[model samples]
Target: MKTAYEILDVSEQASDNEIKQAYLQKVKQYPPDHHHNLFQQIHGAYQTIKDQKSRLNYELFDYPEADFNILLDQALVSSEALTLSADSFDKLLRASIDDSIFQFSTTHKINNT
Candidate 1:
């Protein structure tokens, strides 16, 4: 699935004017009269990230389309080649817990101080 940015062929950091220009170019290339579905897709993509607020909202809420079967297939394929020793897994868990505790303590100190 193409993101709005991908559909419009613009970078995430593109300015509003740049986004608008890209949208205009897309519309010209796929006008509604001649290419209804493509035009709708372009128009919808434009509406999603046309401006700063809309872009922010889209980023916050938009979930990419996913195929669960493909994801499961990939996960199953990868799992066969990857194995974790018990000791390594234990160390990883301990490290993650320690890091979380450190971060919490630091944040708490900063908030209180």
Candidate 2:
């Protein structure tokens, strides 16, 4: 629930240029030889708030759609446990498909680019 302003170490009254400057400064201070998880978080926050439309989306607390699909294998469950109903299985399958498509498309686009 943290706001982009808080995440970027900038004030709410910070100008667009100031925000960018702060983000760049923070990134440089971070350890960058590896994945640098903190840097990525900072960068993501900056990216989210930099664009006008994205800023609006952030302020509005809008989130992208997500399909929750987690397959539970029967073998993983105890024999005494109840079985998954057909309706629940169907829902899970649909969610799995949606999640797969989303991930595939995103990865393909990045690789192609």
Candidate 3:
């Protein structure tokens, strides 16, 4: 739900040139091969809010309490999916759980009671 500008230490009003420059700086500091999770998240955030046309489509809604560390990890997983090479295995795997998230949400907590 956050923007790339925030992650890259740049202003939201920054222009394309500014965004690109910021991205380059971050890449130099943390390349994907070295910082896989962070790089994946930065890539996702940049893609989501880079252009005005796409930004408008981005949506956020108030939810119950959320632990950001977990949410960020899930986002990172989704971002990694975007970078998969076409040569990657085409098979899809699906699993189901009783929880609403199908066991995906960071907020999911087991009640031992």
Q: Itemize residue pairs with steric clashes in candidate 2.
A: none
All candidates' TM-scores? Answer: 0.55, 0.48, 0.46
RMSD of each: 13.2, 16.3, 12.9
Give the range where candidate 2 is weakest over 10 consecutive residues by summed lDDT: 66-75
Report the lDDT of model 3 for residue 26.
83
- Candidate 1 regions with alpha-carbon error over 4 angstroms: 63-113
Candidate 2 residue lDDT tens string, 1-113: 66677778876445568889988888778845664887778888898767433453444343333111111232113222266677765554444344565567779999999
Q: Candidate 3's residue-wise lDDT over 11-107, tens digit each?
A: 6455556767777788888899999999988777667556433332332222233333443344445447676554431221111122344344434
Clash count for candidate 3 is: 0
Positional deviation of 59 in candidate 1, in angstroms?
Answer: 0.7
**Winning model by TM-score:** 1
Could you tell me the lDDT of residue 57 within candidate 1?
A: 48
Q: How many clashes does the backbone of model 1 have?
A: 0
Error of 3 at 108 (Å): 30
Which number leads on lDDT?
Answer: 1
Candidate 3: misplaced stretches above 4 Å? 59-113
The TM-score that candidate 2 achieves is 0.48
Q: Would you list the C-alpha lDDT of every candidate in the order shown?
A: 0.70, 0.58, 0.53
